[model samples]
Each structure stands twice: as C-alpha cells, then as structure tokens.
Target: MTVLTEPGVDAAASAPVLPAGPSQNARARRGAPSWAWLGLVPFAAYVILFLVVPTVLSVGSGFFTEDGTFTWGDVAALGDPVVVQTFANSAGLSLLTAVVGAIVGALVCYALLGMNPEGAVRSTVDAAAGVLAQFGGVMLAFAFIATIGIQGVVTVFLQDALGIDIYAGGTWLYELPGLVLPYIYFQIPLMVITFMPALAALKPQWAEANLTLGGTRASFWLRIGIPVLAPSFLASLLLLFANAFSSYATAAALASQGSQIVPLQIRTALTSETVLGRENLAGALALGMIAVVGVVMALSSLIQRRAARWQS
Candidate 1:
C-alpha cells in the first residue's frame, strides 16, 4: 500500500496524542468523591467526641486547681512517695508481662510456622489468639477468680486433695502477683497476633542460602534470623508493654483492696469518697500514663518501619 505525508508533518505527528494536565473538573473528579469524605464523617466524629475531647479535658484539668486557677500542684503531686511507688509498680508489671509475653508468644509463633500453613491447628490457634488477646476486663478477672482464687476450683481441690492451701501463704491472689498472671494471659495472645506476621515474613530461601554456605542451624539464627527479626520483636514487646500499662478493668477487679498500680491509683484518686480535690490528681496521673504510652507507641512505630523495609 502506498501512503502520502505532508512535507511539514513528521512521522511523530502520527503518534497518539495525550492530554496535557487534567482540567479542574477532571482533577476534582479524580480526587476523593463527596461520599468518600462522607464515609469518614462517622469516624471523624467518633475521634473528636471520644479521643480528642477526653484527652483535652484530662490534660487541661491537670493544669488547674480547685479555684479554676492554673497551677502545677497536681502534676507535682505525681512525685509523691505513694504515687511514685504506684508508677514504679505499674512499670515493673508492664515490663515483666511484656518480656514474658514476647518470649512465650514468639515460641508459639515458631511452633505454628513449623505446622502446615493451611492446617486446622494453625487456624484454631490464630482464632483463639484473636479472641483471647481481647479477653480482658471483668470477665477475665471473674474467670481467674473461679479458677485460681482462694476458694476457686483449683485452690479448693489442692487444699482438699493435697492439703495445699494457696491462700495460706497470705492470699497473694489479690496482689501484684495475681495481676501479673492475668496480664500475661492477655499479653501473650496479643504478642502472638503482633509477632506472627514478622515470623512468617522470614523467607525459607534465607535459611536455605545459609545452609548452602554450610551454616549451622544455630549459626543461621544467631547471624541472620535474630538480626532480621529483632526490630519486629522489639516493636511487639513495646506494644505489649503499652497494652499492660493501660489496662484497667482486670487490675481493678482483682486488686480491690489497694491501688498498687498507676491505673488503680488514678481510680482511687477519682472515686474516693473521703478524698477531695483529687480529681485533678487523677488527670495528672492520666497525663503521665499517656506520656508513657505515647513514647512506647512511637518507638514501636519506628521499629515497625525498619521491619517493613526488610519484610518488603
């Protein structure tokens, strides 16, 4: 076939033409639709009403005294001996639970990884973990009370069958030790959920490559595996710590006798009938808790970013 072209028309002119930038209306159409923004209204309203408002109120209340005059008295009161002890106890509990939970949960995740990914056992464990991780508050405390409290089934059985009385050692079930058990119970499951994806992200080829180089299993882990998973592990640990730090209902239900932890102390400050002008103190305590949680979460986010690079 013969074709003719104009002298000034280059072959490039035959190529398909593309539009310059989109028009204002076209750009507007490409942007989020009105309904999409509308979809976020409920969530935005929720955050403003619940999170933003409460945080503002708590932080603002902390900076004021009974006479509505600004003061640092409430914040300074956080340094009181009893308050300091409460914070120390809370930190200790969070650290203990986070460490234990990370260890146990990582072990559990490793075990799951060894199983068939599609197997019922792995599915069941994941499902159970999802449920148990969120299983806290009054119900969890009641479960513990029924199982291991002074007159609990296990306690009663041990006392009757083996002459071993759990409470004979001064009823430790209502103390810090008691709180630790329940906190760990929930913490482990949460750690499992948070750490599993990181564990799964470990490609088999890495280990195979290590073996190709005659690396021992222990050496492979000590060199590559540990280093690769460290960030995720640390992030999960921080999350567990924050989770334990902010927990309230389980501790409240168990430790009814005293405010051994910061959350309990805040509760006492806010609710004690005999105490007056402690509401501001409660706000101060909440602000401190917020700061601790904020730092932990921030660290977790940084670690997660580092982990994402490797996982990707």
Candidate 2:
C-alpha cells in the first residue's frame, strides 16, 4: 500500500500525452514534409545577417557610448526635433503611401481577380508588376534617372521638343516628386502582391449572396468585401511604408540634399565628424522604423482578429 502511493509532481510531470492525429500534429512531431523549413534556412540566414543584425546593432549602438562605453543620451535624444521630424515625415509618408497603395492595389487585384485575363495580357501584367515590386534602391533610382534624367529620353523630349521648362523652373529630378516617383513605383507592386492572396480568398459566392439579399453592389463591397480584405490591404500598405522609409539609395539618387529622411540621415551620420555619437542616432532611427513596422503589423493583425470575431 505504501509503495502504491503516487510519486511527487515531478514524476507525474514526466508523463507523455498520446498523439492526437497523424495529419493534425505539428511538423516536428508528425514527421511532416521538411521542404518549407529546409528552404527557410538560407532565407532566414539572409534576414538574420542583413536585416536582423543591422537592426539590433543599430538599436544597441544608440545605448553605447562612442568609446564602446554606454550612455542614455542615445535613448534620451529620441526626442530631438530633427529626429522627431524625420520620424514624423517617415511615419506620415509611410501611412499615406500604405493607405493609397492598399486601396489602389486591392481595387486592381479585385478587378483582375474578376477578369479571366489570359496568355500575353496576364503574363505581361504579372511580369511588369513583379519587376516593379522587387525593384528598389539603386536600380530603381537609376531606372528613374534613365527615364527622366537631365539627358533622359523623356526629359530630353519634354525640354527640347515640347519646350516644357519643367526641368528649368521645376527640376523634377531633384525634388519630393522625384522621390515619390519611385515610392509609387514600388508601393503599387507591394499592394498588388499582398492583395493577391486576400483577393483569392474572396469567394464570388459571397458577393453573389450579398447581392441576392437586396444589397446593392456598393453596399456589399463596403460592408462585406472591404471588411474581409482590409487586413491584407493594410499589411501591404505598411510594408510599402517600411520599404519606402528604409529606402536610401533611391532617395539619394533622386535628391542631392535637403530631403533628410531618417535612413539617409543615418547614412550621412556614418560620415559625420561625430561618427561615433551619430551611430547612436542611426540606431535610434532604425528602432523608430521597426516601431513603425511593428505598429502596422499589429494593426493588421487586430483588423484580422476583429474580422474573424464579426464572422463568428
């Protein structure tokens, strides 16, 4: 009877549970396909080396003193006007770009989803969008330069043939609009790619049902379609903002100076007299970008959760 007494909690805690199902368990336990994870290694390494490391270094560097000693001035200077202004500009532009790109992209995807576009048209459009979305930084800047530079084909035509003095009175090449040209270029493609999945999730029967229920097209779209698609749209938009705000080469290629984006500021700080101190500034700026991206991702997740709740 004494031997039959149960052991302590630690002994019971060592017990294992039965498998729920062959197909339902997680990959590690169920011996599921490893392709996804196997493929993820290189991609993950790239992200860790390039993106994550840089981000951590930038944020941590801000807290460390120039001589490898640490201080709070880096964190404390988070409130600097120039720092504040750069973030404000970045946040505002990112928000604006995300919103605009999301709307336009969703609409475009929706239109395409409904359309049975075939062959050349579909391939051509897909190719073009892919190129634009994947294209950024220096390559995009150079493309913009080639298309609309001082001696660019379009610029030359606009100036010489049309006698348009846009470059004369308005050097579109060295201004906010110039930066916007590339932003819009990349932003639209991001929206298009991000929305494609959501659009695919859109069941035509849902639209049909709504319309059958005496709901007008606009009402169905406003009440139903948008609610479902909002998360994807917002996520993509935020991504666009992140891409645009983090972008350095394109902006640098576009503007000689005075734009003063936070990333560019960080790059400039690298070459500053107080390079050590400025690296901290650069770190703070990066943390700000991460915060922006985090906020956007969180918001989209919330929207998705709310949508699910409403559905349930």
Candidate 3:
C-alpha cells in the first residue's frame, strides 16, 4: 500500500498538520516543564559530575601517571604478585562466605520449618536481622568491637567474672580464623534471614505426605526439603558471599593490615598512593567487584528459577 492511501495514514492526512518553525521550537524547549527539567538538573549534575566524570577520569587516568605523563605501566602493573594474591584471596573469601552463609542460612530456614512464627519472633528476627545486615562498614566493626573487642563487654565479663581470657585463649582477632568469627556472626543471622522465607514455604502437609509414604524426618528432609530449597538456598548463599567479599571496614577494623582485603587495599591505594599512584588499581578492583556482584545475582536468579521448577 502507498503511504498516501494507507488507512491510518489517509485518516491523519485529512486533519490540518502543524509545522514547526525555529522560533516555535525554541519557545517549546524554553517553556517545556521548567520545574520538571530543573528538578532533573541536580540529579543530572550528580550523574555527570560524579559518576560519569569520575569513571571517565579514572579510565583515562589509568593510562597516565602521577605526573600527568602517558604510560602503559599502570595497566601492566596489575600483574604484580600483590594484586594477584589479593584477587585470589578475595575470590576465595567470597566463595567461602557464600558457601558458609548459604549452608547456615538454609539450616536456619529448615529449623524454623512448619512453625507458625508470625508475631514477635518474626518481627524481632526481621528488625534484628535488618540491623545486623544493613550495619555496614565502621558501625558494624564498632558493634563487634563492643561485643568482642579486647575491652569489649564479653571480653571484660569473661576476664573479670570467670577469670577467663579469650585473647589469651588464642582468639587472634587479627588472624584469618578470628576474622571469620565476626563474618560468621553477621552471616549466621544473615543466613536465617535469607532462608527464613524459603524454609517457611515448606508445608507441614509435605512432611505429612512423606511420612505417610513411610519416609522419616531425615529421609523426607533429604529427598523433598533439600531438593526444593536448594536453588533459593544457593541464591541466598551467593548473595552472602558477594556481600562479605566486597566488605572492607569491618574486616579492616577487626583484623591486622596484613589481613589486607581487596577493598582495604583499594582504599589504601587511593589514600596512600604510595603503591605507584595506583587508584586505577582501585578502579580495576571495583570493576572486578561489579563483575562478581553480577555473577552472584545471575546465579541467584538461576537458582530462583530452579526453585520455581522444583516447586512445580
């Protein structure tokens, strides 16, 4: 069909069509919802000034040096053992946190199975978990310190009242194992929170059905519960891992500089710049972090889809 004879085209052709002139276009642009456009100015300003500008500068600056001289050394410098070790360690930690958190969270979810935990338990769990989970960086570190730091409440109580010394008892908060204590502390509650919904989704009827079919609690859990909750469990686990991996202040505050998490190294590089003015190292590290977060979310999505299938 010709454009002139096309049904909708012919119908519109009958109506008087207005033409735009330069003056009208200018006026239109000027009158165009000034407040709406004005409101966006601040947001746009932030995006341009901070996010876009900084990203561009970082990318551009990565190819330069502290003296504004161009060089390929910065990009090539990522091959350093320090960088490699940090990446490997962070990756391992991320995976470890994910697995540990997932298992713990799943168990917590399972334990609360078939219970009517609606009111106080639910609210308290939610509020407390929210507090602990959202409690990031320095605040979280301080909270742990208050609870378990040398002069912390638990430490003081153990030392004075029970004549016990956790520090002397080999609780090296500066060590990796000791590092996991706080990680686990936050992670256990996190796991319970992550798996609580999926666990509660396990109906008593399913258990009853299994038992009627001659399956014991252990067998039912093994066969039915495990398979059904696995995806959601994995999703939550990946989330925990990602969160723990990207974390900095909590680990820094709890451990020694020798413990050196990736984020901490990034911060140190940004602040000190003694490591070859390696803020691009920070950017490269950030890009890696973004990639990890994407992978975790994607895995979570995959697991969620699988869980949906299992439920079906």
Candidate 4:
C-alpha cells in the first residue's frame, strides 16, 4: 500500500476540502446582476407615493392654514374638547373590541390546536378567517342593515315573534354603541388570522415536559403555556386595536347621524362648513391617529420579536 505524493504539496490539500468563506447562495447573490434589485423599485415607488407622500401631506397640513400660511391654530385643535372626546370614544371602542376579539379568537385558536392542521374544519376556518378579516366597509354595513335595521328581517322577526323591541330606547344600531358589534365582527377574524400561527408554534414537547414533572393540565397551561403565549397575545391585541381604531366605513355607515369617533370626526371636519376657520382640523385628527397607531404597531413589533425567539 505505497502512496506517492508531491513533496512540496501539503497532505491536507488532498483531503476532502470544505468550501471556505461565503456559501453558494451567498456568492450567487453577490454575483447577481445589479438589475436584480430593480424588482423592489415598484414596491418602493408604491410606498413612497401612497404612504410616505400622504403621511407627509397630512402631517404637514396640520401645521398650516388653508391659505398655506404656517400657524399653530390647526395643531391646537388636538386639544379641543370635541376632538378630545372623539379620540376618547374611538380609543374606548377600539379597546373593547380588541379585548373581546382577542379573547374569543384565542379560544378559537385553542379549539383548533388539537385538530388536524390540514383537516376540512381547519381549512374552512382558515379560509373564512382570511376572507372575513378583510370583510368590513359598506358591504358589511349594508348586510347588517338589511338583517337588523328598522323594519329589517331580524328586527321584524323579533318584534313579531318575541315581542322584543331592539330599538325601544332608540335606534342604538345607528349610534356609537352600534359600531361595537360590527367592529368586533371583523376584529375576531383578524385576531384569529394573526394569533393562530403563534398557537401552532407551541412545541408539543413543552407540554410533555410539564406533565413529566408531575404537572396537571391546568398547571401546565398556567405555568408554561400562558407565559410563552403572552407576548403573542398582546401583539395580536394591539393589532386588533389598531385595526378597529382606523376603521371608518362601517362606523360611517352605521352611525351616520353624528361624528362619535375620531375617524368620523375627521370626516365631519372635512365635510362640514360650520367649523369655520378650521378646515385643516381633519389633518390634525389624522396626525393623532397616526401617532397612536404608530406607537401601538411599534409595541406589537417588539412583542412579536420576543415571541419569535422561542418559535425560531
């Protein structure tokens, strides 16, 4: 078994050589044509045009008069009693809907957790959630009106069948209180869509380990499950809150009699000539919304990052 090799060559050179430095994928990416980055151009342009430009215009308008003269008057509208009350109403509505939606949706996710991931029920639910999450606006409002409005099918049925008066006090369905049901309607589906993945990411081994240590089912959830999912739950809650806060069409359609929330208030500011010398007030309200939503989304991103560590 004599082996011959060049005297000057290193023996290690003949050994199975491992590629050094960057990976094939990395090198291929590095060598890619510069034109490849152009794929992002359309998306970047879209964001700049739709998001960046509108945000800047909206925020900037808040500090200027209708004549383009800079003034703090418009900004001061944020402190107005009416504006403040509108914001409070919107926040309260959003909070209520978010909490309700998160709890109900979390329960739904838990129910689905033990089911086959690809089963008929799960598939149908996933499809329905995806659709319903985006199912707000005038169409939803119209559906509600057709089903439960004054003289509508359900209203008539309840009045005739059970002697019930849904509107005995007043037309609550066309008021601020009315927006709650519709807001929660879409919020639940959205919560389900966002929170389900986090639920699915919970490793079965964690539960097994808890049981191995002589933990009861209740104890396992209280000690391990709740702590692990808390971040994700909070993130989804914030997301739902933001979704509800920014909702306009459903509220607009249902509560057409008054500006009861921030979005509707903005609509009033833009449409009404009664509020003289404050035409730019809508911009101020918009800025307020942007600030609130921005803070919430930032918090959500941070919590999502924490939750992702365990999933990864």
Candidate 5:
C-alpha cells in the first residue's frame, strides 16, 4: 500500500537546516556587566587629575613667559652651568643608590629565598619592606637627621666615647652628600619589595633538573639564575633610579641650602627671588625631570617584558 503525505510537507522537511545562534548562557559569559568597569573609573580619574594634568601643565609652562608669550629662554636655562651640574648630581646620586640598593636587596632576596614563604620571618620582612619602601619625604629626612646629624644621637655618642667627630670636615648632613644615606635607606627596602618577586619566581624544578645533569649550586646560579634574574635586576635598578631622581621632599628638607640636584634646582627656581632671566625656569627643570623619569620607566617596562617570559 502506498502512503500519501500532505502537500509540501515532505519537501519542506528535506530543506537544509541552519545552525542556531549562541545560547543565552554563552552570550552572558562572553559579555561582562557594564557596572564591572566602574572599578576602573576611580583609578582613571586619579591618573588624569594627579599625573596627566600636572605633567601637561608643568611641561607646557616651560615654553611660555610670565606674559604667556612663547619663548625658548626658560628652556635654554637648562644649559646653564649650574643647571647642568645639578642634573649631573641628580643622575650620579640616583645611579649610586640604584646600584647599591639593587645589590643589597638582591642579596637579601637570596637569603630569604630558602626560607618558608609563609613563615613568620618571611611575612614580617615582607611587611616591613612594604612600609619602609614608602618611608621617605620629610619623615625619612628627620629620622636621618636625628640619628646622624650634627649633635645627633650617633654623632654625639661617637664624639664623646671615641673622641671622633663626624663633622670635623664640616656639617655634611646639611649638604648634597647627606642625601646619600637617606636615599639608600629607603632605596634598599624598595629594592627588596620590587626584586623579591622576581627572585621567588625562579622555579625549583630548574634547579633540580640542573642537579640531575650533575650541575652544582654555583654552576646552576652562574649559568641559569644570574641570566634569568639579570633583566629583573636591571628593571628594579631603573625603578630605584627613578625613585631617587624624582624625590623632592627628602632632599629639600636635608639639603636646604643649595640646588645641588634637579629637584632642589626646581625648588630654587620657583622660590628664589634673586633668580634672573628665568621666570619659568621651574617648569623647564620639571620638564627635564619628566624626560629623565620617562626614559628610565620606558627602559624598565622593556626589561620587565623580557623578565616576564621566564616568570610565566
């Protein structure tokens, strides 16, 4: 017996079927809620207000006169002998602190590497590092002054006990040299905080594998550890350099008499009534600082990218 189907029913069923669009669950998974971006709003606003706005104003002000007419004289002041010396001083101090801090901090990280990461000692050091790293500005300067300045606790004690005077040459604590110790003080902790993670990121499996190949500890470090950590070390060093270079308050508080560094030079330009022919010199000095810091940070970012390869 032959069966008869409804007209067009068999033909319609034979037509090719299209795939359905993504399900509601998948669409939901792919798209985030609009409110989720609210978290970034505060951070974006902060950058715009504090960093971007100030940088634009400071750098832009350099090219204009007090009358708001554009001129190159203020920027030309950067070539003044005093200004050049100040830049050199800042660069030298920053380099010294960065080198010393990076080495000492790397050693500390190495010492802590074998300790229990979650142990009391490690946790305490981490916490202390975080705090001390941020312990700069006038507070840090005051601490150093109290400890080692003329008639300071340590200075007095040494003079009385050993008949040795720290200020026999002069009161260096109030000079550019005084900044060295304070900068290094905070620089070390900052280094520890920044470099510790890179040191910790070193894989133990690599060490074991090295040993499996009959390599010694020193051999592994010399061949593997040093190479891998070099990028991170360099990056941290640049960060420390930037930190010291941009510091104003500590240097201002301690070395109040002279514009020996760029930051202090900017202060002098801004506050000194006797400053001649450079009304906007402060802005020019700030522009120079921005250039130096921008270059240093750019290098740091490039090095960090290289370091991230091994970290991952």
Candidate 6:
C-alpha cells in the first residue's frame, strides 16, 4: 500500500546508524586519561633513580679499564679461577636453600590448609611469615650468632649441661654451612608467603569430582594436584634461589675470613683497603650477578603465567 511519508524518511532509514558515542575499541586505542598517566610518575622516578641508573653505571663500568679506556680486561677477570669458584659457591648455596625452603614451606602450607582459615594459628603464622620474610642482613646474622654462636646462649648451655661442644669440629658456622642456615631461615618464610596463595587456590570441586569417579586420594593428587601446582612450586623455588643468590650482609657478617660467594667477592672488590684497580672488577662481578637474577626472574614470570592459567 502506498502511503504518504515525511520528507527524508527513506534517506534516514537507508543511512548507516553511526554510534552515538565513540566505540569501545576507539576509546581503548585512545588510551587512559592524562591524569591517570600521572599515577606512574612516582614509580617511574623510583626505578630510574634506584634501579636503572645503578644498573647502567655498573654495566658500563664493567667494559672500562682503570685508565678509563674501553677494555675487556675486567670482563676477562670474571673467568679467573677464584671468580669461577665464587660463582659456583653462590649457585650451590642458592640451590641448597631453595630446595630446602620449598620442601619445608610446602609441608607447612599443607598443615595450615587443614586448619580453619580464620583460626588464631593460621593468623599468627601468616603474621610471623610476613615479618620473618623481611628479617635479613646484619641483624639476622647477629640473631643467629646470639643463639648458636660459640659463646651464644645455646652453645654455652650445651657446653655446661652436657660437656658437648658444637665447635668441636671447628667454627663451621662461620662458613658455608653457617651461611646456609641463615639463608634458609629467611627463604622458608619467603617461600610460604610466595606459595601459600597458589596452594589456597585449589578448588574443592575438582577433588570431589575425582572422588566421585572412584579415584583414590593419592591418585587424585598424582594426576591433578601435582600437575596444577608444579608451575607455582617451581616459580617459588626460583624466587628463593634469587633471594639467596643476592643476599650479602648475612654472609658478610658470618664469613669474615674471605669472599666465599659472589656478593662477598663484590664487597671485597669495591671496599678492599689494599686492592687497587678492583672497582671495575666489582662492576663486572655485579653484572654477572645481574645476569643470574635476570634469568631466574624471567623463568619465574613464565612459570607464574602457567600457574595463573590454572588458578583462573
């Protein structure tokens, strides 16, 4: 049926209906507001001033000689036997602490999981983990000394009470064994803090389903729990490794004899009274440490992505 219509009615209907506002894609492409960008200013300034500047200076100094000329001499020193051994010692110490911490911390997390989430025990452990994770440096060293050192409370009590000497085999606590104890002291708490969230993310529905399907508890863990948790576990291990690898003050205070690990070596290179031309050497050693930490963190991030997929 033909009917009279308003002028431009056909044109209006035929024309494309453009959006009343910008498309989401367009708005997203336009990015955040200017004021929102200001939020990053403080973080950027912090990285620039503290991390980036120091890292660049260290790396740049590694390539320069004592005479201020570009040279590979300092880099070459990194290949020396002593330097190689120091790196080995650091790697071994980090590995030992990471493994020990991961195992013990995982056990502790499992114990906590069985308890009421809001219980006093869980809350106290969480609070203690938070504080102990940050307890390091000279203070941590002193605490260990006061508790287990030659004339420490425990040492004296054992000596008088049982006539047994912990230092009978010599002062091993002032060596690698000693350093391992302190490193693990902090690493275990740090591991708990880093790993507990992932452990808590396990869904009960999956376990219920497995049991309903006639799967035993051991089988469920073998097939589901371990597979789901492996990434998070490895990531936590890498974090522990990096934490131990970079620690200095505790080792410095305990191992007062010489540079037993890379950090101590770097400290000696930078601060030795008789040493000359070692400033650049310190930079080279620091660069090596940076490379190790960078690799560890990179692997950690990749594993965390895998872990996130399961948790999500």
Name the lDDT value of residue 11 in candidate 5: 56
The residue ranges of model 5 lying beyond 4 angstroms of the native Cα positions read 1-33
Clashing pairs in 3: 105-191
Model 5 lDDT per residue over 1-312, tens place: 656667768955756696656796678776865577889999999999999998888877899876788988888988989889999999999999899999999899989999999999999999999999999889998898889988689999999999999899998888988889999999999999999999999999999999999999999999999999999999999999999999999999998887889988888877887876664888998999999999999999999999999899
TM-score (all chains, Cα) for each model: 0.90, 0.78, 0.71, 0.90, 0.91, 0.91
Better of 3 and 6 by lDDT: 6
lDDT values of the candidates? 0.92, 0.72, 0.72, 0.91, 0.91, 0.92
Candidate 5 clashing pairs?
none
lDDT of 3 by residue, 142-199 (tens): 8777888888999899989999898886757665655576676677678787778777
Stretches of candidate 6 exceeding 4 Å from the true structure: 1-19, 22-33
lDDT of 3: 0.72
Q: How far is candidate 5 from the true structure (C-alpha RMSD, Å)?
A: 3.3
lDDT of 4 by residue, 106-179 (tens): 99999999999989999999999999999999999998899989988999999999999899999888999888
Scanning candidate 2 in windows of ten residues, the lowest lDDT window is 1-10
lDDT of 2 by residue, 1-312 (tens): 223325555645565676777566665565755566787899999999998898788777877866878788877777888778877776666667766776787777876776555767556766788888888878888888888887788888887898975577677767765676678777887788766766677677888998889898899879988877666566566667777767777787777666467766777666666445466677766777777777766876676565454344
lDDT of 1: 0.92
Alpha-carbon RMSD of each model:
3.9, 7.9, 8.4, 4.2, 3.3, 2.9
Estimate, for each residue in 156-216, the C-alpha lDDT of model 1 and write its tens digit.
9999999998787787879998888999999999999999999999999999999999999
Give the poorly placed runs of model 3, Cα more than 4 Å off: 1-72, 161-163, 169-171, 203-205, 255-259, 310-312
Deviation of model 2 at 210, angstroms: 2.9
CA shift at 296, candidate 1, in angstroms? 0.8
* Per-residue lDDT of candidate 6, residues 82-154 (tens digit): 9999999999999999999999999999889888879999999999999999999899999989999999999
